[model samples]
Target chain A: EDKVVQSPLSLVVHEGDTVTLNCSYEVTNFRSLLWYKQEKKAPTFLFMLTSSGIEKKSGRLSSILDKKELFSILNITATQTGDSAIYLCAVALGGSEKLVFGKGTKLTVNP
Target chain B: SAVISQKPSRDICQRGTSLTIQCQVDSQVTMMFWYRQQPGQSLTLIATANQGSEATYESGFVIDKFPISRPNLTFSTLTVSNMSPEDSSIYLCSVRQGALTDTQYFGPGTRLTVL
Candidate 1:
């Protein structure tokens, strides 16, 4: 069975603090890992990682994948209240478009 | 990425009733996906609707319960039949660049509350 697990189901932090969200998976025929941020309803695309070591960054948000360890991390530096949302991690099944998702980490950045 | 939209942003439905959620895309797409998000839970794929074919439902989801229709390239609809309290959830529709693409753009989602 394919499974995706995310750590720290919920977190509370102050503005200007940095936070790291974790995601690990167990699945056959690995394909790719993706991150999304859901503020209210729809989740917005964040980063998609397929190779190890290589990192993808956008502004203060960055993510990296470790295929060997079957895990990935999303880092948000200089966090602001606008960054408060539910961060979701999903892994796509190889040779298929199906994605297994984790429960997500809810981050609340207090002003 | 495509501009996706869903109708009835929020609704309160009574038990034993039914609701049909419509999904529309700004551009033509070969495939459209329907997902369900339970309260405080992750998203789950309910079915994959392809034009000119029957919708392929995932495990634990049946066509009789969640009927889907793909009439054209840019439009699809999912109907929740015989609604129950457990059927209350947020239904979202998504579309990717291609059939093999993994990145998907989502709709705002229809929040259904069954009472």
Candidate 2:
């Protein structure tokens, strides 16, 4: 069975703090790893990492994957209160387009 | 990116009742996905709905309990039958477009509360 595990189910941090979220997975075939920020009912796309060692960035947020170790990390720099939300990690199955998701990391940013 | 919409953003239904949630995409899509997120839980795939074939359900999900309809490329519906309090959850609709690695976009979701 394919599974995705995320660390620090919940985190509390003050504004301007930097935090790192982790995701490790085990699947039959590796395809792609995706990160999403879900503030409410819908999850917005953040990054899709398909290669190892390369980093994908968007403003204050950045992510990188290590395929050999089968894990990924999402880093937020100078985090703001607005960045407080559930960060989800998902892996796309090799043969199928199906996505297996992690329990998610709930980051709480306080001003 | 696709603009997706879901009907009846939230509903309170009586036990044993049924409710059908609608999902509409701005553009035609090849595959649509239905998911359920239980309270405090991550999203779980309920099924994959295709335009010209029967919907494929994931493990722990069956067609009879959660029937799906894909009448066209731009629309689909998921019906929750014989609801119970345990069935209360947020049902989300999603679509994948563009290249093979394209991320799936989700609808606002329907929040169901069974009493």
Candidate 3:
């Protein structure tokens, strides 16, 4: 079975602090790694990392994949209350339409 | 990316009563996936809904318990049969625009609380 594991299940940080969330996976055929942020019901896309060492960023959030290490990390800088949410990491297997997901990291950013 | 919508954003149902959740995408998608999220837990994929064929269920999931129908490319439905308190969960629908490596967009989700 394909599995994705995330570190630091939950974290609380003050405003302006930086946080890093980690994700590691074990799959048969690797395709891509995806990040998402869930505030309420739906999960909004954050980034998709396919190659190693190449970073994907959006505003205060950035992510990178290390295929050799079989892991990925998401970094949030200058955090704000609005950044409080569950961050999810998912890996897509080659030749499959399903996504294997990590348990996620619940981030609480206090102002 | 696609705009996805789910019906009955939330509901409280009695044990043994079944519920059918609907998912609609703004555009035609080749692949639609169903997932379940229990309280304080991550999402678990249930099945992949094909546009003109039967839904492909994952391990530990069965057609009798979670039947799915994809009448067209833009719409699908998932029915939770013989429900119990254990079946209470947040059900979500997602779509992949192009290849399997493409980003998946999720619906608002149906929150079902079985009592």
Candidate 4:
């Protein structure tokens, strides 16, 4: 069965601290891996990684994929309270539009 | 990326009642999906709404419980029938623009609280 697993289900960190969230998946014919940040309502798209070893970055947030290991990591540098949200990782399978999502990492950044 | 909107942002419903959530996308999308997210849980795909065809539900989900409608390319609805406290969840609508490689854009989601 195709599944996505995210580690460190919950984390609390002080402002200015950096954090790393992990996601691993096992799927048939993997096509792409995506990261999303969910605040209160919908999850906003963060990054999409299709190739291994290439990092996708947006400001303080960066993510990289590893096809050989079937895992990915998202790193946030100098986090702030505004960065507190649930980080979700999803994988899309080839020939299918469905996205298998991980349980998500709830990061709470305190000032 | 597509812009999606959902109606009834939050609702308090009594048990035994039903709630229908609406999803609308700015552009015509190729695929639409309904998902359920319980408190502090991951998103689970409920069904795939196909335009001009019946919705395809996932394992452990049935059409009679979560009926879905996709009348067009950019509009769809999901109805939670015979609700219970266990059904209290965030119902999200997601859309894929062109192909399987396209990222799915999600709506704001309808927060349903069953009491």
Candidate 5:
């Protein structure tokens, strides 16, 4: 079975704190890894990491993947209350486009 | 990126009833997928709906319980049959565009509450 595991199921931090969320996967024919921020019902796309040792960044958020170890990490710098949301990690298989998702990390940013 | 929309943002249905959720894409797409996220759980792929063929369901999901239709590239529907309290969940619709590595854009989702 394809599996994706996320650490620290839930986290609470004050504004301006930096947080790191982790995701480790075991998939067959791995293709790519993706990160999404879900505030409500819809999950918004964040990053897509296809190569190892490379980092993808968007403003205060950045992510890196380590294919050898089959894991990825999402880092948030100076988080604000607006950054409070569920961060989801998913992996795509080579032959199939379907994504296998992790349980997700629920982050709470207190003002 | 594709703009996806789902009908009936939410619904409260009685047990033994069925509800069909519709998903519409702003542009043409080759693959559309249906997913279920139970309260406090992660999203689980229900099936993959592709035009001109029957939907391919994931393990633990069957066509009879969650029938899907993808008559065209831009639209699809998922019908949940015989609702039970256990069936209460958020149904999400997603579409894959461009390449296999491309991100799948999702709809706002339908929140279903079965009583």
Candidate 6:
């Protein structure tokens, strides 16, 4: 079965602290891995990693994928209260449009 | 990326009643999908709505209970039939543009509260 697992289901940290969220997957013919941030409504696209060893970054948020380990990690630097949300990781299989998502990490950044 | 919108952002319905959620995309899309997210849980794909074709449902989801319609490329609807408290969840609509990559955009989602 194809599945994505994220570690540290929930985390609480103070503002300005950095956090690293982990995602590991076991799927057939993996194509890409994606990260999303959900605050209240829909999840907004954060990063999509396709090739191994290549890092995708947006401001304080960045992500990378390791095909050999079949895993990915999302790093957030200078965390803020506004960054508190559920971080979701998903893997897209080759030849399929459907995405298998992890349970998500509920991050709470305290001020 | 596609800008998707869902009607009836939130609703409270009684048991045994049914509610239909509408999803509209700003631009034409090739594929649209419906998903259910229970409180504090991950999103689960319910069905994939293809333009001018029948929706393909996932395992554990049937067409009779969760009928879907995709009359065109930019519009689709998902009807939750015979609702119950357990059916209370966030119904989301997603769309993929060209390729089968990980670039699926989602709508704000409709919050259904069955009482």
In model 3, the clashing pairs are none
Candidate 6: list runs displaced more than 4 Å: none
RMSD to truth, every model:
0.8, 0.9, 0.9, 1.1, 0.9, 0.9
As for candidate 5, its clashing pairs are none
- The DockQ leader among the candidates is 3
Question: TM-score of the candidate numbered 1?
Answer: 0.98
Model 5 CA deviation exceeding 4 Å by range: none
User: How do the residues B1-115 of candidate 6 rate in per-residue lDDT, one tens digit apiece?
Assistant: 7789999899999999999999999999888999999988899999999888889999999999999999998999999999999999999999988764668899999999999
| Candidate 2, residue A5: lDDT | 96
On the 0 to 100 scale, the lDDT of residue A18 in model 2 is 99
Ten contiguous residues minimizing lDDT sum, candidate 3 chain B: B95-104
lDDT of 1 by residue, A16-95 (tens): 99999999999998899999999889999999899999999999999999999999999999999999999999999987
Backbone collision tally, model 6: 0
lDDT per residue as tens, model 4, A1-111: 999999899999999999999999999989999999998979999999999999999999999999999999999999999999999999988987678999999999999
The Cα local distance difference test for each model comes to: 0.93, 0.94, 0.94, 0.94, 0.94, 0.94
The residue-level lDDT of candidate 1 at A93 comes to 91
Model 4 residue runs over 4 Å out of place are none
List, residue by residue over B10-95, the lDDT tens digit for candidate 1.
99999999999999999998779999999999999999987978999999999999999999999999999999999989999988
lDDT of 4 by residue, B1-115 (tens): 8889999899999999999999999999899999999987899999999999999999999998999999999899999999999999999999887763558889999999999
For model 3, the DockQ equals 0.86
Clashing pairs in 2: none
Error of 1 at A20 (Å): 0.3
Give the per-residue lDDT digits (tens) of candidate 5, residues A55-76.
9999999999999999999999
